[model samples]
Target: MAKASRESGTPPVERAARASLHPVPDGRAPASAEAWALIDSARQSYIDALPIAAAVLTEQDGDLVVGASNRRYDSLDAARPASQPMPIIESPTIVRRLLEFFARPGDELRFEWRYGDQVSGRHFHACISPLAQVPGGNGRCLLTLVDRTTEIESTRSLRAELLHDSLTGLPNRTAFAEAVDEVMASNDGARHAVLLIDLSRFSRINESLGGVAGDEVIITVARRLISTLRAGDILARVGGDEFGILLRLANGPDDAPAAARRIQSVLSTPFRLARFEVGIECAIGVALVGEEQTSGEELVRNAQFSLKRAKSTGRVEIHHPGEAACARYKLDLETELRRAIDQGDLRLAYQPIVDLAANRLTGFEALARWTHATRGVIDPGEFIPVAEEAGLIVPLGRWAVDSALATLAKWDALAGSAVPLTMNVNVSAIQLARDDVPGVIAAALATHGIAGSRLTIELTESAIVQDPERTTKALQALKALDVKVAMDDFGTGYSSLSYLRRLPIDSLKIDRSFVSGMLQDRDKVAIVRAVLSLADALGKTTTAEGVETIELSQTLAALGCSHGQGYFYAAPLTADAARDYWQSQL
Candidate 1:
């Protein structure tokens, strides 16, 4: 047989191919001459059809002989002549290296190699695999060349889409959630930290700047978070204007607070969006993952709860799931609350709302009291919100209304005369939201044989503001039937002036916070004055609550606040005690 032609130089592409076709120990017999010829012919055909250069090599005595070459391969290797034999020993140093790789005994090897000194480019992922056995003693290797630059570029594009936010090109929620899950699964028992970030007053930004600017703010926030986080940490947008972060492999609980402080530092900077420079502070809730026995869902929930607690306490950040006390206290309270409402353990204590000018009892505000069969006289503050959260407020409100009406009827029959008495009952938001509230009130009034005017309904600022349009319509139906509407706990919320003007309110009760501080604080006095002025402007009356001391009562009267109710007049009394107290006063 003619000596196989040796290309003078092996390019990086050819070298990579030779490396992939390391000798294998399959122990199969070598192909016969006729079969070898057919295989070489097929290899030639495959090389010819390829878009890039290709070649085949045979290892003989630690030297590579070029068995075949495509037209592109011949063009790239200018030292080679078609159908001419060249000695491998006379070729360049790179050809020697290619021959050495094929002579080695192994299955495969892969590596990246570069070519062309001036216009050099990096080609990745050259692989080698055994093609067939050698003719006499050992198996021969078949090598093929591939240019992986295009495939690598395509892979880069896909990775960008998979890991980044489409709008801002920042790492997205998917990447963030995966990072958190991984960190939580780590074997290191050290605490991990999760930061729950919520934009304070973002609704105002959305409303004022429109959604486009709002999106820009979100993008800006994403960038800020990226800059704030370490390499292993992750940040994601969980809700509108809400972001979550996970810090992996944290040192301890001490590390979490430091991380939170660092995040705060970044967020406190001003952001310029659509020509408006707005500063945002993140309400951060930090929860230690390993210590809390937390899963992904539990960690997020605890962080959110901590964030709420932080915001309520006027802090920028808070670490929560801190102790089991908070969650346990809440659960215990919820259980007691449900039991109290269901088992008739809840009671109503009637506080006399005196007409200060006449010293006569007009009506009573039915204050909620929980006489826990075990815990005695639980404060309304302790259980009222629990009831609301448990969705028991509707039933509880109905009970209070019905009981107050019945008490009014009983006192009337015992005193042997109908004292022009109006019973004031507090209503919750859920109660007002119910479509049956009006009918419930009417039925209670009819059952007591009392006119609608004898029932004065008190609603907190939140109840009316929850859904003002629907609540106003409901209140209008109640007003049409001559039921008096009073906005209770006034001057403690937003839109108080708007509420008094829009709703068909008969009176406004100044919140005790403002009344109690009125004697010493000018701002409290000013708030009370402003409320009274607003009520007067709307042609509504005012009641001052928390008139505990004589000084507070005298000061409230001096401020032109007429109706007063508190321990100064009489502490909340039982129905029978209220009847006797009213009789004594009369």
Candidate 2:
């Protein structure tokens, strides 16, 4: 008994002797002294060799008793001293689970429990198996415990890493989305707002420095943005240079823009990046959570649409109803446009540019037109911006260049001579910046056996002024090909004479707004006259747009406007119609 007790770390003989209740209460015969001794010896041997904590629990009449327990089991309770041994089955939860396991009579029953405080808790998985073979030990069970603290803590760490940004240690998009959902669901009565912040020209940082420097900038910006938030606001790194914030507004929708301004104010200061102090600007979009905006994803998406608009205006924009729907439609349209470009499903229409004095067709400006599979006639105004945003402008611009030059070749073939027509193709700022505009134009001119002098590349004022140095280089390259360059919508953008003289431009297309009412509006007339005078002085020609009346055309010609294009000449026409129009003009 002493040897067994020493090995098992429990005085089994004393515990069995002190037991008042009988195991054979139903009148079954009790085991012999030698048989009980043998049973105790086997139980001690089973738990003694086990690495984990082990114990034998048995039911005596209506009460529970510990039949045998190993040294490891006694050590499970940190509060108990080594000199004083106590059974680890003292927990009420463990006891209840063990009692339930005893009644189940299963092969094995498993459960988990924790000890100590939540922050410093140790977890354990306990398994119980029936030991029904012991005589007068009908409800006896064997229990073993496996510590699961390390595994549980490791799983929690991984989960935390997944939801947080590694560099900034901020919540990630998924976690932020989840948090937004929870906030909305929990407080339906209160108003909420979602703000999306996009760093303007953020790519310049990464391009000029490196990705490591970009990461540092983002982290610093994240900290600065957090400083402007309220107590309940949730900020997350949602994109490469985008951050999202969820604010529970106390005063309603009006608070949204104010919060945005606060964020902007915090970021107005320059950031000290390495040895360089760089000024950064941001565009913010706010979307109020209406009754209809129930999900976090929807709110964030609406805010994103607003953010896109804000980027253009460099202001804090609030989301309006139907904007989300419009944004989604644009997204779908962009995808379709990409497919259309790949499949050559797009075509161009030509609008005649007439010589004001001679009333003769000088050239045709090629306008892109798309007829959807079902939606017939998609406007260039709609899809052009989408293409620019989605980076599809490069390929689309390439295709347009080739197609326009190819049409010019076909027209030359039909006329039996090189038609004195210049194909004016509209080129986007994105094409100038990202695409090889000069190379593309040169290749198209070469492919169609067309002279570069017969092609004119039209650009918006905004396009030229975006990156003037780069634009000048690109324009110089195009000039080397002997192609003409015309600035479209001349008066609307910067309109700096410095740019006019610096660029190797041949003509300027007066914006339709100024030309539309130039005959009546004195201000419009003056603007047109000034543009014409400037163009003539720079040795460049001028094309007056939106000339709808004979009086307007005569008036423009009298004012020395070299060319005009509008309904007065012709609407944009197909290749066949354009050829016919040119032939008739002859």
TM-score of each: 0.58, 0.82
Tens digit of lDDT per residue, candidate 1, span 181-217?
6666766524567788888878888899998888888
TM-score of 2: 0.82
| Steric clashes per prediction | 6, 0
Off by over 4 Å in 1: 1-187, 197-244, 249-284, 289-301, 307-316, 321-324, 434-436, 496-498, 517-537, 551-559
lDDT of 2 by residue, 167-241 (tens): 889999889888888876776524778999999878999999999889888999999999988887889998889
Candidate 1 TM-score to native: 0.58
Show pairs that collide, candidate 2: none
- Model 1 poorest 10 in a row by lDDT: 81-90
Highest lDDT model number: 2
CA lDDT of each candidate?
0.73, 0.84
User: Which whole-number lDDT from 0 to 100 does residue 80 have in model 1?
Assistant: 39
Q: What is the clash count of model 2?
A: 0
